[model samples]
Target chain A: MTERMQNAADAGPGPHYLALRDHLAGEIAQGALAVGARLPSERQLQLGSGAARGTVREALFQLEAEGLIYRRDRSGWYVSPPPVVYDPTRWAGFMAYVAEQGRVPTTETLGKQSVAASAADAAVFGCAIGTPLFALDRRRAIDGRPVLVERILVDPVIAPDLLDEGLDGSLTAVLTGRYGVRVVRNHVEMRPCALIKDVARALGVASGTPGLLVVRRSFDAGDRIIEYDHEYWRHDAIRVLVEVRTRD
Target chain B: MTERMQNAADAGPGPHYLALRDHLAGEIAQGALAVGARLPSERQLQLGSGAARGTVREALFQLEAEGLIYRRDRSGWYVSPPPVVYDPTRWAGFMAYVAEQGRVPTTETLGKQSVAASAADAAVFGCAIGTPLFALDRRRAIDGRPVLVERILVDPVIAPDLLDEGLDGSLTAVLTGRYGVRVVRNHVEMRPCALIKDVARALGVASGTPGLLVVRRSFDAGDRIIEYDHEYWRHDAIRVLVEVRTRD
Candidate 1:
């Protein structure tokens, strides 16, 4: 090794906080910082990078906020486990997804009842204003982390009184059990949206936090936009996958 | 409006800076803040919101950085137009995209080319490691705003001289120009991704910026993964829409 290389190695780093962040990033890229790797404490980073205590802590906070790392109070920070790449092609439902991951799934229905549709809501739902529709506001959490907030609009003609039933657990299950409505296919549109009003409060992020706006319409055996819903998801909490194929 | 509503509206907001941001956000939501609307100067905002000059400037910087606003040197900040929603499923080729929008399309190669496939990449392209390939990195801007950075891994067996032509313009056009290879269909997977360093820099965002990871496997008339390309796009720069029907 060159004398300069040796000296540089012995000296640890050139810039304190930047150097520590760089090392961690490199480790993550090389899989050295494997998914769920428990990162060293702030004190350890201070020692490792020869930086001030405040600098080390700031770097850690930035990474955690970005979803690259997480903290557990006395337990300190740890590498955030990568989000499971959810393939839309698989067409899995909420219940199936949670079961596969072996996580206890819970739903808190903020409100589940018929509401008069607004003009914008009516147009999207293909109905007129004052049309009684089942509107559900659901907050979904996995392992106690708020992952997504969804507002689902269901057509009443297809599944009557869906709103009246006290919804629990899976959304798909409610449709199937109450009205025998099955989702044979679905179409989705993905867009970028800033959180508004209730969605922001539910996700525990500041109002106007950037989020993924996923507009999905479920179809039955016949083609129709029966269930149109809007999902505002925590960006780090979910990853969507799509597959494209060649046409003959 | 009720007197209570008027008081709520006129009350001195807790934070002057936040109130300004909220006002702009409300205007945008109401369609009153049209795209390219020039915002008031920092002094004007400070006077209007009862905030410090530093606080007002900070807010403008944040808005400009987020693509919600931009500065034209001495001209000050203005609202940016909403980004185009790009549907990879509806069409094929970058050239076609511009043409479809009635915009002029162009290309400019930015970096060197190479050939060597990783195990994962090999599987995606149905090729072997060390397969003759053209690795091209391209930065594409629509109407002068840098929107996407694409890294294309092309199978040289199909078009050996792909490297000879810099991937500045339409890749699909180049493939067709050289080898009768046309992208008749594409399988696209859309997922949320934090940007990599190089891609983030090219897209004018901070490292690990939240963007879209769209992996498209292009195919000709015959079913084949002709080329496997990874496209990184700014979240607001594009949207993905898919239309589906029940399988008979």
Candidate 2:
């Protein structure tokens, strides 16, 4: 442990916890700790580093903050995979993109229900208040780790009996194949957010965990709103990419 | 306090801490607590709610996670302002967008240096390794609160005296006016990140604070990479909006 501390000191100068953090971060960056690899227990780390429990925990927390690792409730810590790159302008659905990125993707339907659109919903959907909408809640996982929870509100007028369809597949594919409704445009808004209780529970994280909130309004050929979606993603799970080309 | 708890209970069924969180969230949502308003001290909140100290803190942590409030070290909590809407596809610079949203914006140049590009920088710039470059670091604030820190690297060959110019203003304006270099296109990538020690100190937040990282490569009329920027934003500071329309 003293020799390891000496190596950490050579890496940089800081508090004891910071040295520990630097050492661990170096190991992760160098792939000594592979992605999805479970970390040693905190007790083990404390014993190995000769640091107090609180110091060891603080170092681990720093690594977590840096998106190098994550914790599951009662399951222990694991190295986080590289974030999936997401281009919002692309039309490829979630399943296709995740698969293209060489990761296994799966979705589970958490809930489905009929809902009455509120005034805010009416404004966004360009429909009258009280309009019936199909609401679907789903949890998506990459490599068997839950990363995002999404709620989709569909205008029942566009896709009748949508709730009866199998929802584990891509909703976009379903809309295009069944209803001939193609999303030609999207208005997306993303921000940093903290997970609420229900969403946190769905993603298997704490309620106050920092997250990324992405809201999308999808439109069809005639520019009519087809679906509105709210996605709550684990903060470390994805990276958004965008490209803008100048018009000639 | 009991009456407040009763009101919270009416809102939802949850633990005492959750009820308290709900009650405060309701107030913020209803505008009873305005943006940028300082929250009551924890002691005051404890006295007012008649909740235990830990319970009060737990509720506050929940609210913080919800992006309703934020804490400054050694300072009490404050109501987080509505995030400034950021459209990466738009050509307008940060100052313009921030002012358009009715908020004050300010920038300060933190450091400037002349450097030799590394292999990674060389690849990004399409220049040879050890090519001379100018690096600039700046901090941007909204309504007197530091919200982002940005590091920009410029191909010095394009603008020989880049480091000598006043950097407190928009670099886009400077590039266009001084070098006749207009940024006609941009490739942007964004992800959730944790602030490292130096950046966190500049933003007055704890090291490893959750943040958003946005990296942009700006191109000129010839499609040459003119500038590369890495921006670290407070996670709660901005919301990104993008509009994508399919070609007819």
Candidate 3:
């Protein structure tokens, strides 16, 4: 049981279990549970709170099912870190997603390559079949939690040198600093989809976990689609708030 | 497996299993799955596919895992129809989501009344805490498959007759038809969320299943926010599509 929960035990029926559960919930709400904190084991909760083992186990089970906690087999239960926040409206990319949400981010650039696109890839990037495209893939994490697998596709005619630049900081920075392209508008489409095999494995979820699919086409100052890309994220990891405004 | 699977079994391995899975997927893709078609049993598929019971079983398992098929304890597996098409962008209310996808719909209103608002409920309707509000709750379906649980909050002054009229077709239709408060614009906020106990039970899924959180505010020709509502859609049950244009 968390310390906060133990404090609540005296006034409640099933005080022991209720106290522990409440305590853990409060800590999580207060952001004090700290990502990856080792939670009390099932047996420890029973002994500390003087509850039946079944009650303690049930409480742990509920938290795990709610995505509030995770277990690593013999490692016991640990608090799940907060989800990554992403805004499709901004062309700021995933690094911004973490920083804007007030979390530190660690980025690993998987690759930056110039490749001829496959038919499916061409269809998405809105380029001719077999056109050269820039593929930049990155894995973004916040508070040590894997959040999104993002792959950006850039049209080579617009930003030929983009493939050579480091993508650790920002895509927008490269477009502006290196290629003199300013992203002015973006068209985004989002849907709920199953995580493909690679994404499931990378995100440490079971295969076929539902995921969010975000496809965005970003425009340059010239009103050209300089970048058209697809990104996937773990569902239930974050909530996307889209405020659609109409002309007055 | 359905009757179609049985007939497909007469075909060779080159086509039987692929054909079986495709046929079912196509039915779903084309919206011809029609909600509650009885799926054949594993034993039945074995007899029909001419493939091993295992092959048919694998296909069934894949579809079930995909939420395209579901089973009742005593009843057989059945097709889960596509989610009723709903969009947060349209001011036409719930019906626009379905009708836009070229599907006909029917509604049975659970209850409708003018309510003196509770603080929480009033905030959703954009009304004062004690102002009269038109509150509606509905059970909506597509092709006989239950797809959405819709709750709407509207200003009572503009929709005084909404409670008197049954809410079967469309909420926006009622507002436009009776009050002349036609929907001219909508502001939508969308997020990925997990179904808690109450929403899960209503949507026929495990509580942990992911959902689409769509909160929308509809505006009339006068640019006033007329109604505020939210909807929860089963992720596996629907696909929302948008045509993305290159920023030209």
Candidate 4:
């Protein structure tokens, strides 16, 4: 056993888990374990630290709670990557921003359908409750890890053939190219929420996992609401940055 | 028993909890149980719903995960209030914003101390490492429930004698009133994180609870970093809104 593991074993049961947690945290902090690297199996961790299986699991749980690591169902734990910086004020598309940050971005179209607008949707769109709305579900990933799931709702009158176009790419580009609609402004609201069942399944996290919900209403030059988007992001996957100057 | 409880009883063990969860969720949605209202005890819920104690607890757990309810240690659960809207681009202070939302706001100064700047702090403040800084810790509440804990770090060179003033009120007012330091701009970064032990304790939540961490660096007209703040908010307490317009 290593000296740190020996020390953890000497510390007895109560503090043993903390020692292990600190040891692994130190490894990640020192870049000994790079981001997205899979951790050893629980049995291996237990054996390596001379700690009980429960103690090893507790240590791993602490690290997960600290946002340093995460577990995939049935899959092993892995170090978490640094959060991607998102600036909604920039009006950049997802592909543009992620690439600018030097990260690989991918989008998968999950499904699409035509749905009647609900009362809340009608209020936002200022249309009849049963107005036809095209709903597109897409999952976005960074470095092969799924990070967010978005449901984009577009009024059918605004983009009649939107469903026929390719959607495994940036919707911003498609809106500008096909519909000649340039998004001029957006009103965004974000809150911490829990992942619903469908979103959790798509993101490969357990239902009820904490998440960040961002709702954006995009408007065209004439102040027409062009698209409404609901984005559910993994709690650790993104950091929101905003710079505000005092109004003159 | 009410018809809803009878329906839950007939739904079998697996779906029984879901029925109860939906019932309570409906109550919360319709405002039958107003925000911040205490929930019935677990035993009471079990007796009322005619379900197993585990089933009642499971339903409550689901609601908590949905951000519709929350627990307060030994205290019983309470209905979660609507999130207070926060617009960082506005130059309003905490008291101003919360009251504008029609919610009561209160602040309590927890403690204060002088600390030397670390490498990261020095980088942000453009000061030498080990420079003296004033650190003020405060907890803010809405409707009698603590929601956030903030640590404000001030450069003593810019706002000397700041520690000697009353901090139970908005620091923005103190900065303008006493120090003649008007914050002209701010850079804010926010992310969902797990609450550390001390912060969780102060907010009366369990350690490692999901939280929203917001870090703001406020600057003066001369572009001097005046105050750097770290705010840890309950995951369900606030919503962030930002309206971005296309640059001309």
Best by TM-score: 4
Point out the higher-scoring one by TM-score: 2 or 3.
2
DockQ of every candidate structure: 0.26, 0.40, 0.19, 0.37
Fnat score for model 1: 0.32
- Ranking of all candidate structures by their TM-score, best first: 4, 2, 1, 3
Among all windows of 10 consecutive residues in model 4 chain A, the one with the lowest summed lDDT is A1-10
lDDT for model 2, on a 0 to 1 scale?
A: 0.82
Per-prediction TM-score of chain B?
0.75, 0.91, 0.68, 0.88
Model 3 Cα lDDT, one tens digit per residue, A139-227: 76776677677777788888777767788777777888888887777777676655534566666766555667677777765667777
Candidate 4 lDDT, tens digit per residue, B90-139?
88888999999899999999878787675567888888877778888889
Model 1 RMSD vs true structure: 7.1
lDDT of 4 by residue, A98-162 (tens): 98999999999987878767656888899987777888888999988999998888988888999
As a whole number from 0 to 100, the lDDT of residue A22 in candidate 3 is: 66
In the range B1-248, model 2's lDDT, one tens digit per residue, is 12222223244455778777877887887999889888889999899999999899988976776567888887889889888899887777889999999999999998887766755688898888777788888899999999998888898888889899999988988898999998889999998776655678888876655688889999987889988988889887888998888876
Instruction: Score candidate 2 by TM-score against the native.
Output: 0.83
Provide the overall lDDT of each model, using Cα atoms, as 2-decimal numbers: 0.65, 0.82, 0.64, 0.82
Where does model 4 exceed 4 Å of error? A1-26, A40-63, B1-26, B39-63, B74-76, B127-131
Looking at candidate 3 chain B, the ten consecutive residues that score lowest on lDDT are: B1-10
Which window of 10 residues has the lowest lDDT sum in candidate 1 chain B?
B1-10
